[model samples]
Target: MHLILWRIKMSNDNLFSKAEIKYLIKNKDIVIGSFGLAAIILAAMNYGILYLIPGIILTIAALGMRGYKIYKIYERNKKIERTRIKYNFKKIKTMDGYQFEKFVADSLKLIGYKTELTKKSGDFGIDVIAKIENKVIGIQVKHYKGKVGYDAVKEVHSGGKIYKCNEYWVVISNNHGFTRQAKIGAEKLNIKLYDIDDFAYLLDFK
Candidate 1:
């Protein structure tokens, strides 16, 4: 009975794995590439037929259809990637607020920074304490489903000043990415801001 239960668990695990999602993405890309090539060929044939307006219109329509198909495929791939990351994150053992901090600390350690998980509540925006090159660095980690705007960055900068640390880092888990204004704010405050994609890269997720 135990053997049967173990086999069932293994089968269920394999059924929900990301390997299938990756295979589907590969097939979708192949189909998109073939459609793109066909559209290009049709456009080339229609280019010389300046008088055949209908043919030109049909070629343009085909190109647009291919573009829409490719866009949908890319969107689906992004969703799959996000789901995979979320699943991996859930598997790590950490509390709600501590999860992002733990991930940052692990990544920093991987990059040769000595990290300490702090319990200071008044940290305001700061999360992790890191030591590098004989200097203490304050890290503020934010896990959001939306964009990390100027306010979040400003809070981290202020926390950095309060802590009197050598440097400050604001790491956000989710965002539409940084805007030009947010980048300028970071520059002015001399603080480092990392978005979801940048955090993933630093953690060697991809």
Candidate 2:
């Protein structure tokens, strides 16, 4: 419990906050880098190495900040990878429907798939559409406690036709997985069903 809480804290993600706005105001790399360049220009003046020293320092700091930002993103993705390995669905269940759809689309992108989220209201039945190479997949995302029912599978199966998808799927991240009827219908309709266990592979795309 302590470890999990610590991990979440270190992930630096909060439920709500304008972190981006704050970052842009405080840590704009272009502004810092420009200052560095200006300082380097002072090196040509009588001050010489004195200004040059601070210029190099600030330039390096700007680069290091950018690298750190990239590293943080890589670490965030790795945390998702760890969750997949641990088969932890509880965190995923906390997301709202729209959040769940976005999360699924983001995961697909990590593994080289180009993903698009359908409109919230007029999406037919699908939440996310993904493409890799020649294949187009329509996916319905469910982030619920109970087992996903047959209706979800049927809905995605039908939605796939509207979107001209080559494959269809119903994905649920909760532990309950899919009902027997859902599994049956998915098989008959050739629609894939991804329960908690099967859903883990979505992150790795393997």
Candidate 3:
């Protein structure tokens, strides 16, 4: 049984992209458990506890279907620490550009860098600057949806020179992410792009 499941996962892992893999692993428990629980609730409301026993068992079975969520949550929480800044996807999606930039700065500082936010006016393009010993990193925050274009890559690349930054990055709220031209430009310019999924680990929010 275990061999068959392993073979199935091994075959399917090669068939899916990283983003798709994360989405499936991250949401599958919730989706399946929710459906099972709803079914159980409906059965309970319509019938007596005696008649609902099968439904309750099915819900518990579903909850454990993909490696019990209880263990998964415990394993996941074990890695979380008291980060300097706490953030979540829902809150991040609602923040304005200014708030998002500040959050980025705080998150960077959480990981040992000294960070500063550039002024709103006449700042050229850098939204945040992070320094650690001799290295300086320039960052731009975009709390927006849709594809980020080559222009954003250009903005940080040029702005990095002004800030004496040795590295450059763009933090984006949208996971759909950068345009093809933006990706090409980033590769050529040696800039990294962080969509929400990437930043989640970077920030290490609990």
* Highest-TM-score candidate: 3
lDDT of 2: 0.78
Model 3 scores what on Cα lDDT? 0.76
Instruction: Give the Cα lDDT of each candidate.
Output: 0.66, 0.78, 0.76
lDDT digits (tens) for residues 1-206 of candidate 1? 23433444457557645555445444544434454455556656775444355444545655676678789777656755674375465443344657767877876787688998777477667788888897888888876666667876788778777777888888876646666777779888898887655565555433
Model 3 Cα displacement at 128 (Å)?
A: 0.1
TM-scores, all models, native as reference: 0.50, 0.56, 0.58
Candidate 1: TM-score? 0.50
The total of clashing pairs for model 1 equals: 0
Provide backbone clash counts, one per model: 0, 0, 0
Residue pair clashes in candidate 3: none
Per-residue lDDT of candidate 2, residues 1-206 (tens digit): 23433344455556324454444445556556777888898886766788898888878888887888889778757765675755445567578989888888887787789999999997889999999999999999998889989999888988888999999988887768888889889888999887655566446433
Ranking by TM-score: 3, 2, 1
Winner by lDDT: 2
Runs in model 1 lying further than 4 Å from the true structure: 1-95, 204-206
Residue 1 CA displacement from its true place in model 2, Å: 49
Name the better of 2 and 3 by TM-score: 3
